[model samples]
Target: MAEITLFAAPGSCSRVATIVLEEIGVPFTYELVRFMKGFHKSPAYKAVNPKGKVPALIVDGEALTENVAILSYLAATYPDGRVLPAASTPMAAARIIADLCFCSATLHPLVTRYCMSVKIGGEEGAAAVKAVGAEAMKENAALIDQRLCEGDWWYGDAWSAMDAYLYWVFGRFNGAGYDLSPYPRWQTHAARMEARPAVQRALAHDEAAQATLSAERMQMGPGGAPKAA
Candidate 1:
């Protein structure tokens, strides 16, 4: 097997790939892309991923982007690893893909809109955008919470890659002060994800990467000049 390299950013959706990789129990190299510092837009990184997105997986010298595609690839390549649900039938497989698509295409953008309303909407319009995004997020969260209330995992009996994606999204919004108290089932789902060893390891790596970035930023003064200690 060829060497696998994962280009990721801490606290981003890229963490999904890291968690899946950890679950796969395969040897791979992780390269942190400091997205907050605009490292993803650098020429070097742009060469790797023209879209300038995190979670680019380099397998056999070819780069793969997007959570849906990458996660699907991992699941397909390592059937025995069971990174995703082992669909017993064609319709079952489609349902799993549908859930993944719903997360990426619908839920994620709403969260992103709320989190980056200032960028998505002009300064004068940011408040309106955030308000609308929050309402939509709340509705979506409720649906997810209702589904999760039925079982321990999203897909009834087993944990799938969708759980990792949902956990990250829910965790991000919760951290951003979204008042998740109304969604106890969602909270419990996140707690269960936190209890997973692979998730714990991935979170530790994310925290360490974030700390390193924070320390590096602190060393620089307000204008990007080195601070005199």
Candidate 2:
């Protein structure tokens, strides 16, 4: 077994970890959890990550949850990769960590809440919640645009996991039915990011999973519950 193993679901924020692992040129095995069946909530997975979040990494037998920790671990372990700041520059590393937290903690969850709130709150209440979520999405998008306008990447000219996380969160806007044209810089960032081999590979994997799930649902007929790929 590979020393580094990642438990992830395709198209989730776990994609960021996949990108970071690829960027750092680290080899690892992927353990895919069937989310639709509540695989993440099973006892077996809780041993790996008690929080039950995707992108949990088992490195040298110690499981690390949260994207920031996993990403920073990869970058720092492979410091020569140049995808992250040097440990010697504590301030720089701190800034990148900050950006990672903001995106993971704030931007990503807002979009997720907007998407799933209907299940928690009733449909009528969900509409109002989603409205607020949509506006927040725009504000976050604008914030990212302003950052990109100031510089090519979030931290600096060199791309880092921050850019990858930004790409993942902002990409959610398209599904949320937000107008992306206003954030030209974000669009440009997405274009540049899509050209990267790592991101391309991750996205292709996600799309394939979605297609497979769709086909399976079609086979099972109307009574069959469509599983989230």
Candidate 3:
């Protein structure tokens, strides 16, 4: 396989896929798209991802957008890595997809929308957006916590792409002050995910980004809310 290159930004959804790559032991490169500099919105970056978002995977010269697609593709191509189940049946695959959707459609988006309300709309709309977003995320987090309570991983016994995404979203919320004390299982999940070698690697790479994020959160006053990218 051609070396996979991930065009990513620190603290972006792309980081989830990047961590997947690390866990799978795939050789890859990561290019940081500086959010503060608006590099992701640049014409150069847009050429790679029309949405101009981070976490675009370049396999050879073809770019794959969206963390869900990239993660699934990596798991499919590297079955030996076993980061996700091969799914002996279609129904099994459907279950994994369902879990992934909970993260992508519900958890991830809610966090992103709330944090970036000022950029998506304006400060005038932020409070209303955050109120709705928080309720939605809390509900979504509760659902995932329920799943974690049932099993060690999001997809039963094995680690899956959904686990990586869920863990990342969980960290984002807790780090931003959503109060993980209410969700004990999810808090435990975050702690375990952080201890993984792959996750630790991702965090090391994301150190500078985390600093910027901390500063941004302080500026936002709660939520680590951001200007929408």
lDDT (CA) for every model shown? 0.87, 0.79, 0.78
lDDT of 1 by residue, 104-162 (tens): 99988887888778888889889998888899988899999899977998887788888
Tens digit per residue, CA lDDT, model 2, 154-223? 8658888888888887677676667889999999998888999988877766676667656655664456
Best by TM-score: 1
TM-score, model 2 to reference: 0.87
In candidate 2, which residue pairs get closer than 3 Å at backbone N, Cα or C atoms, i.e. clash? none
Question: Candidate 3 lDDT, tens digit per residue, 146-178?
Answer: 878777787677877777888878777766677
Q: Give lDDT for model 3.
A: 0.78
Model 1 earns a TM-score of 0.92
